[model samples]
Target: MTSDEEAFRRMVRGSEAAFAELFDRHSGAVYRYSWGLAESRDEVADIVQETFLVLWRRRKEIRLAGHSVLPWLLVCCRNTAYNHNRARRRSPAGELTEPKPGTHAWHRRVEQEQAVEELAWVREEIAALPDTERRLCDLCLIEGLSYDEAASALGISPSAARKRIQRARGKLRAAKTANL
Candidate 1:
């Protein structure tokens, strides 16, 4: 059997067969991971497709971790799931059928609305942060980048990235408490 690293190298060199081999080997694991993060089967399928699309588009830039491409693919899957969920949260809520008053469904709907309102308030707080801190939150908190990755992207030290993210969280927590 060809190793993942060798297959990935061939894929990067523009071999469609190698790319297919990698996809065939890892797509199941990616799909399973997507299911854990996504809410519905359709969403899971979308996430899996986006993950592989990302892998193909960024093939030249990706490096196998620990001699396997699965880790990178899984990370891409997670990031895709997060992006999907975040976009769904930010979009206007669809027309909800009103459940009978005093029923469990009605109560659940009310709770979901309250949660959405809280998420909006939190987004506002993040938006109010200093420019650098806001970027830090978007990268490290929202997009799930590691401190080192965020730091490199932001042209700062990892320690500074960590501190900024911590400070941003503290401010957000304080703001929430004050509002309550």
Candidate 2:
């Protein structure tokens, strides 16, 4: 079986089959995630389509640091649902079913928004880091490499790599406190 990375590389090179294969493998999960966030069947359909459209358009930008693309797809799903909600809010209110503020449905919506916000905030924080630090983060956090493995890959000692990761965590903490 081809790794997703290899299939994605083919996708970037304009292989429709590779893209379809990926879609087949993951669209069900994305749909379920979207359905949980969306209030309507139509909205759920839109979110799933938007998520895959993004995955296709941003093929080169995808950095599937892990074996599965599921996490990234979930992030895309959250972002698409958030965008859809914002657009719906800005547009004229349609005859739609929205949950009461204190209801379970409302809590699910809140949770979905929070997930999107958290992912965006993390991306922003990581992007603010120095290039080397960001690369280390992509390797260690996103790519799921051990500190020792990432260190060797980057020509650094394991301790140094670990220290950099620690610093990255400190930065996140500082940013979180500042935001609070």
**Per-residue lDDT of 1-180 in model 2, one digit per residue for the tens?**
577777788778766656866887889999999988875567998899889999989988889878777789999899899888888778856686889999999999999999999998998999899877777887777656788998998999999888998998899999999998
Reference-based TM-score, model 2: 0.53
lDDT for model 1, on a 0 to 1 scale? 0.86
Candidate 1 structure quality by residue, lDDT tens digits, 50-150: 99889889999987769999999998998899989888878845776769989999999899999999988987898899999988876666556789998
lDDT of 2 at 34: 92
Q: Which stretch of 10 consecutive residues in model 2 shows the poorest summed lDDT?
A: 13-22
Q: Once superposed on the true structure, which residue ranges of model 2 sit more than 4 Å away at CA?
A: 1-7, 10-95
lDDT values, one for every candidate:
0.86, 0.84
What TM-score goes with each of the models? 0.51, 0.53
